[model samples]
Target: MTSYVVSFPIRDTVVRSDNNIPWVLAMHSNVVSIFSCFRRAAATCRSISCNTGNDLSLWAKERVLAPYISSERRNRIERVLENRTRNVVVVLEHLHSKGNENAVYRSMDALGFQEAHSITADEESEAGQASGDPRTDAGARKWLQIRKWHTTRDCLLHLKSRGYQIIATAMNNRDNSSLPVQDVDFDNKIAFVFGAEKDGVSDLAVEMADVCCFIPMIGFTQSFNVSVAAALILYETRMRRIRMFGRNGDLTDEEKRSLLVEFYVRALTSSKARRVLQKYKYDATDSSMTENI
Candidate 1:
């Protein structure tokens, strides 16, 4: 017997076996993979697939959906908005596990980090899609900005241009070059890079990093799981920010309003969203006319 895998773009995944029976699955982000088993007598296989459309900007979509969301839902979105921050970022370098990737996203969301970065040197690896498993991510992927790069050097240069200090997580400090996680100044914009689960941080990433840091561990276990380490580091950073600033850092008012629109759009059904968006466009035009008067 042989099995074939087909991927479809629908929110609800439907898998058809050799008998052409469809198996429906819960909606999830990323390309859905389905397996079909065939009898040994069958020498040929058929394929079915679909392409998801281009991503729409959250800011644009939000403008259309803002008025359709309930006040309670709006309030919840506002709460998320109040705590969201881009001041600190995490960069996962060549992390191979989907669960670990999702765990990191969940941790970042819990600690209110708005953006993350990933670097994968291998051109043919599925590591690029590590963050695509929404089942593991618990919907945290929707709330955070994820950027992927082909090389650590490119990622470092990009972050540096945006004034982010690159910090790599290492097993131990080299000479006097690295800082203790506790001592790193959380007030500054920083990008913390954690390496693959087994390899730790790569030598290239370490070389490109402006600072190298590690969590002080004790007892028989010398290291924490990558996800656990990220959570600990982010939690520490979040607490320091709250203590020093009297509150967790937040997005700007304009940013909140934009994201509010985005959340509203995402919550509505596609048909309702289209109607709401049209109304929003007309309302904006009318407001502009009144302002011109």
Candidate 2:
């Protein structure tokens, strides 16, 4: 008999088994409400064969743990995930202000973009938790994923590897061939790159970008702030996507399922979560759901 263990924040894991392990559980003070459900569920699930760590994790999350989340919360999560788009990421190059980055993320959240990458000037940069305008929320920041890279080349390379078309933002004076922001076509997954407060993107950014775009302005103030540029470009791209597809979001079924699980776990593991481990209500008849995982 073999055992499969799936543990998160892996500490104080209790395994109940001899020849085979029905449940391999790791509970903690933080997510105790989540994993503790497995203890009671284990009794009915003993006949359940050993599943790989991911399989076990999914089952525990969807079957054993998810129902503890309230109906209102579940509906809200689904509604948000419906509009979530996996494409259209943003990149910030050498942006020093956390307030600016936070503002960008708030825009990203509103526009249904899920992730952003930052090419920091150095490893010491902490470009998050803005305490500025649009009133950035620290908790809302957690709803979006922000990754920072130490160099422009590394960030661009990673995005390229993932099939992103790098759309660098520049002024009309800076790049003669750049497309007007609203007119640019989004034929592929995109990474819209914006630069710092005083300076625009790095030379490498312009050189590596697959396409260049700039906002059209008639005023004497020829440029937009970094955050403002990001908002305009992101909003235009998002609206165009909605018009092209006739909806605000285009997440696939698999993507929606994955995000749903994550959202459920996030809600369940929070400090405010109270009731949990509802008397082993899992149905063995729906065993096929675990097989797909």
Candidate 3:
């Protein structure tokens, strides 16, 4: 169960819901293309999941429903699927917040990441709010903050139960003095936990991480944003895994199929737009869905 983490851009259609949709969508699409190219080159891996902040856009949703999309869209997706042979899951964090969630959704549309599963904060919290016309306390909002934290925790726990180590990006007693990013062995299933923007990883995330690592920096900047940090670390880790273990560093064929099916179901059902997955064969007993926070 070797896993790699990637961040997804918001979708374009989502941005259009706001006025600045086009520009935001374009920016994220470029980012998605760049990562897709990297994943293409690193064909020996499977991106277990991408961590997105809330905002599920139409374009982003298309990526998840790729397996069940029209032949044309499926072909486009399959073309990029080359070189990248693993099924990666996308996890959205704290994306339910008003402004950030909207932006993130637009970003996803631009990036072409489909919505799989969303974990929100509790239903009663004041922060559990949504952004839309006549914004009111409909009690329908999900508390994404709580969801994001617990999702990471559960992901780590699940991986650990399967015998994988959990590593986190954080400053430790030995910063840069510890093992270089390239030296980390990623053959075993591992979860790389990251924190929010203003703050580095949460103390809980740091404590839960089996090993805390920091990236080597030379400039005046003390740290990188959480998303950027995650991207860099995932890239480095993917490279190390490929160089060290080759294809064996990735998930088994069985796991890949399972993940693909799992994601397919979620993405297709994310919105009422598509139902193509209804024809596919899936295990009804597979309870891979994460618990709502």
Candidate 4:
């Protein structure tokens, strides 16, 4: 799926309504435009999808609903959807390493990725202890506690299996110097990986990546923090996709349904709820209902 950075001009209050079906429909229209642009520019672009704060909020709601639904049914639905829109997956990995989930959350919020799937080692450890199913629990453990270097490696392998070219951000290398951030071709399914603070990306990450890119910097600082680099790269990719394709490089209708279901399953949680409420408070809105409840 081709991923686009959507810029919806609607107010937050309007988009956050209980009956947000209309807003969703409108947003879908905008996404269609982005998809169209992607198709024209990068004929090889496979699917198109979007990551947004509002969509993530919906996923959090699904988390609340999970326990109420039959696990078999829920899992069936989630798996089906995940498969359907498996083309373009955006990950925010090792973001919690900074010891401030809130900072990472806010950065994702700014990127309109309110419902991005966030897997932490602690959460995975707990899930492992709670589940009886070895397969499910094992998967959770892998997601939660894998070594930092392995995280990027696994991501690259997983995406490549699904026919994606992994593009990662780092200081430019000799072979990658010709392919700067601006020169990257989004015509193919691609995954852009960002590493954690201090160490930047691991050697494995750079090695596994099909292309490495660097953001041209002017300041004395050698590099941007991981989150900033992510935003800059994602924005640039979005812009390039739009310019090349015009508005059509997006997911298929089937893909959209699948992604929304998967996102909803991964994102619905008490932690996410608390995060969203805190966001409202930080923005100086009245959140008494959320708090008192």
Model 4 lDDT per residue over 1-293, tens place: 21323234432212212222122223344566544544432321111112244333333334434564466766765443332222233444555343332343343333322222332355544443222233222222211212222255565676677687777677865564526688887788766666657766567767887888788888999788775676677567656666876642354564444344444334344565446544533221222111110
Candidate 3 C-alpha lDDT tens digits along 1-293: 22233233434311222221121123444676655544442431212122233323323334445645456644543432222322222233334335433333333323322222233456523564334322331211221111233355675565566565666666663333335556555656555555455665555556666776778889999787554565566566555655665632244455334444444443343333343322222232333433321
**Number of the predicted model whose TM-score against the real structure is largest:** 2
How close to the true structure is residue 66 of candidate 1, measured as C-alpha lDDT? Answer: 61
Error of 3 at 66 (Å): 10
Residue 206 CA displacement from its true place in model 2, Å: 0.4
User: What value of lDDT does candidate 4 attain over all alpha carbons?
Assistant: 0.47
Q: Spell out the clash pairs found in candidate 1.
A: 62-261, 62-262
Off by over 4 Å in 2: 1-55, 126-134, 173-175, 269-293
* TM-score of each model, in listed order: 0.70, 0.71, 0.47, 0.46
RMSD of each: 20.0, 11.6, 18.2, 17.4
lDDT of 1 by residue, 82-103 (tens): 9988878899888877788889
lDDT of 4 at 245: 64
What's the distance in Å from true for residue 89, model 3? 8.2
Q: Candidate 3: where are CA atoms >4 Å away?
A: 1-72, 75-155, 173-178, 247-251, 255-293
Order of the predicted models by TM-score, top scorer first:
2, 1, 3, 4
lDDT of 1 at 49: 12
TM-score of 3: 0.47
